[model samples]
Target: MISEPDLVKYLPDCQFGVNSATRLRFDFRNSGSGERVRAPWYRPLCRQDFLRPRTAAMEYPLGRHNFLRSNNLEEMQDVLGRIMCPHRLSYLDKPEPLDAVINSFDLGNLVLNYVQYGVPIAVDPGATGDFYALQIPLYGNALVRSGGKTIISTPEIMAVTDPEAPLYMELERSTKLLLVRADWDFANRVLRDLTGGLLPWKLRFDLGLDVSAGRQCQWFTEVVNLVRRADVGGGMLKGPMWVPQLEESMVARLIQLHAHRYSELLATPAMPASQRVFGQVVDKIEAMPEQLHTEGSLASEFDVSSRSLRSAFQRYLETSLFGKLWHVRLHRAHLDLLWATPEETTVPAVAERWGLWEPLFTQRYGENYGETPEQTLRR
Candidate 1:
C-alpha cells in the first residue's frame, strides 16, 4: 500500500497537502468547464439515480446503503439533522458554497455514518445528548469540542463524544468521516448486564481513543471494516437476520476496546439470572426446533419483557430472538436432509417440514450447510 505522503507524487493531476497534520487538503477543479465538480461518493448501484432512496429493495436492486447528496444546508436538517438530534449545519467559510453528501446505515443498537460536507463546516447541537459517538476521519480531520474537552480527530486517533457532553464539530473542507453512534439506552443495557445493574455513575470515555497502534486500532479497524463490508450491495445484506449480530458485535467490540470508566467492572462482569434464561432459551430452541417461536412468545414463557428478552439474547448470545430460531430451524432441515430416505423424501418436503420454502430456502440452506439440500439428500 502507498503511504499517505506519496499520494502527491502518484496523483500529479490533483493538488494535495496536509494542513496541521489533520486537514487533507485536495483541490480538483473541472478542466473542461470552469465550475467545480464534486468527486463520486455513492456506488454505481445507486449512483445512477440520486432521487431514489438507497434503502428501497424491490424498486431497485439492493438499495444497499442510504445516501444523500445535496448542496442545500436546509435539506440536511431534515435528513442527517433529524437523526443527530436538533442541530444546525452551516458553512464555515462561505454561506452558499456547500457540497454535502451523507450515507448512514442502521445496525439496530448503533448507527454507522459516512459524512462529508465537501466544504469547511460546523455542526452545532445542544449541551447534552443521549448517545456516544465515535468519530474516525477516513480522509481529513475534524475538531471536536465536547464536554469541556477539545480533541482533534485524525485517522490515527478517534474522538469520542459521550452522551453527557455538548457537541460542537467542525470539519475542514477536505474531509470524509465515519462515525459510530451508540444509543444511550441500548448501551446502558449492555453495560448493565456487564456490571449486573446500572452503576451509580454513567458510562464515560476519554476524549480520544488512540487507535494509532495496539488493540484499540485492531478492534476499531475490525468494526469499521465490518460496517464497510455490510454496506455493500447484496440481497443478504438487506435481510433482517443479520441486524442483531451486527449490533452485538459493534457494542461488544467498542466496550472491550475503548477505554472507559467501567473498564474494570466490564472486564469481569457477572452473569445474572437473565443470562441463564437466555441460555435456557437457546436450549429450548434447540430441543424443539420445530416449534414456532417469536420474541413475544419466548418472553412470555421466560417471564420477561420482550425488550429484556431481546437484550438478553443480544448481549449474551450476540443474536436476536428470531435469528437464533431461524438458525435452529435451518439446522433441523439440514439434519433431516443428511439422513433422508432418498426414495421417500425430496428437498422441498424436507424444507417444508422446517417452515422453509423456495429459492430463498435453497440459498439459505447452501449458505448454512455449504451445500444445497438436494446435495445433502443425494449423499
Candidate 2:
C-alpha cells in the first residue's frame, strides 16, 4: 500500500483507503467542500458483490467477469484526477489471479490504464453513445473488430475503435493491454481544432504497442515508471497545480506518438466550405499581423456576409472568427516579445505590429499571458 505521508503529500485533498481485501477506494474533493465529489477504484470481486442498481449489473460481460467501477456522476472528472494524481496501487486486487492487472489514472482530461492478464477475456462495445477506446497489446496476440473490419495486433500491437460504433475484441490466450478512455468533449475538441473541425467522427489511431524494442518503447516505459513512482510517492510529488498540466501533456504526447504511427486515420475527406473559409481567414490574419481590420473588412474580403462569416467560424472553430484572429495576433506578438532581439522589440511596437492599438489590448494581453506586454518586454 502507498504510505499515508506520501498520499497526503501527492493528493492533499483526497481520501485513500482499502475496503476489505479486494476493494480500493480514493475519494477526491474540492478544497472548500471537503466532501468527496468522486470515488474511483478497482474491484477484484465478482460484479454481484457490489450492491449497485440492477441496471449496472446488466451492463456486465456475459458469464464470469472482473471489472472496475467509479461511483460518481462526475466520473470523468474523478477518474481523470485519480489516474494523474501521482499515486500507486499497493496491491493487486487478485493474487495470482492473472499476471494481468488493470492500472488506472486520472490526468484531468483523460483516464488511462494498462491491463495485463494471464487469461484472455472477450469485450463488447457499449450502447448509447459514441466514445473512443484504444487497445494495445503488449504481449501475445489479439483480434479487434470494428464495424465488420477486423485488425489483428500481435505482441506489441494496438488498435482503436469508436465507442459510438460497435466493436468486439477476442484475445488469443491471455494478453496484456493498455486501454484509455477519454472525455468525448475534450477529445473531439482537441482533434477538431487540430484538424480544423473537418472530420466527422472522433479520430482513432492504432499503435503497434511495440515499445519493448525501440526508443519509442523506452520512452513509454520511462513515462509509465514516472507516473507509477509519482502515484506511490517515491519522492516525486510536486504541488497539485502542476499535476494537471503534466498529466495532460503526457496523454497528449501519447496521442501524438500513436497518431504519427497511424497517419491514415487522419486522412479523411475534405473539410466543409465553412471550415475552409475560416482556415483561410486565419491564414490571412497570421500572415498580415499588422493589418488591424474589423470583421466587416474580413467578411468583405471573403465576399460573404458578416453574419455568414461569424457562423462559419462558430461551426468550425467553436469561437468567433474575429476572436480567434485577435488571439493569434496577440499570441504572435507575445512570442516576438519572448524571442525577438531587444533592438527589434518594444511593447508599443509589438502591439502595433499585432494591430492592438486600443487600450483594451493591454488588458486582454495581461489576462491571457498573466503579465502586461511591458512586463514581458522587461523580461
Among these predicted structures, which one has the highest TM-score?
Answer: 1
Error of 2 at 141 (Å): 2.4
State the local distance difference test value for candidate 2: 0.48
Clashing pairs in 1: none
Put down candidate 2 lDDT per residue, 60-131, tens digits, no spaces.
Answer: 211012234432223322433344221112222322232333356545455556554434445544321444
TM-score of 2: 0.39
TM-score of 1: 0.64
Q: Lowest-lDDT window of 10 residues in candidate 1?
A: 40-49
The C-alpha lDDT values of all candidates are 0.62, 0.48
Clash numbers, per candidate: 0, 17
Question: After superposition on all CA atoms, what RMSD does each candidate show versus the true structure?
Answer: 10.7, 17.4
What's the lDDT of the predicted structure labeled candidate 1?
A: 0.62
Q: Report the C-alpha lDDT of model 1 over 1-379, residue by residue, as the tens digit.
A: 1112222322222233322223212223332364543332212111223323343331111125556767788887668866667788877886864666667777666777877776888988755477888787766789998778998888777888878778899999877777777888776655554444447877777888887555565456445444534545332244444345446545655665687887876565333237778887889889986664655445557765444665677687666665676678788888888887789799877766666545567777777778878889999
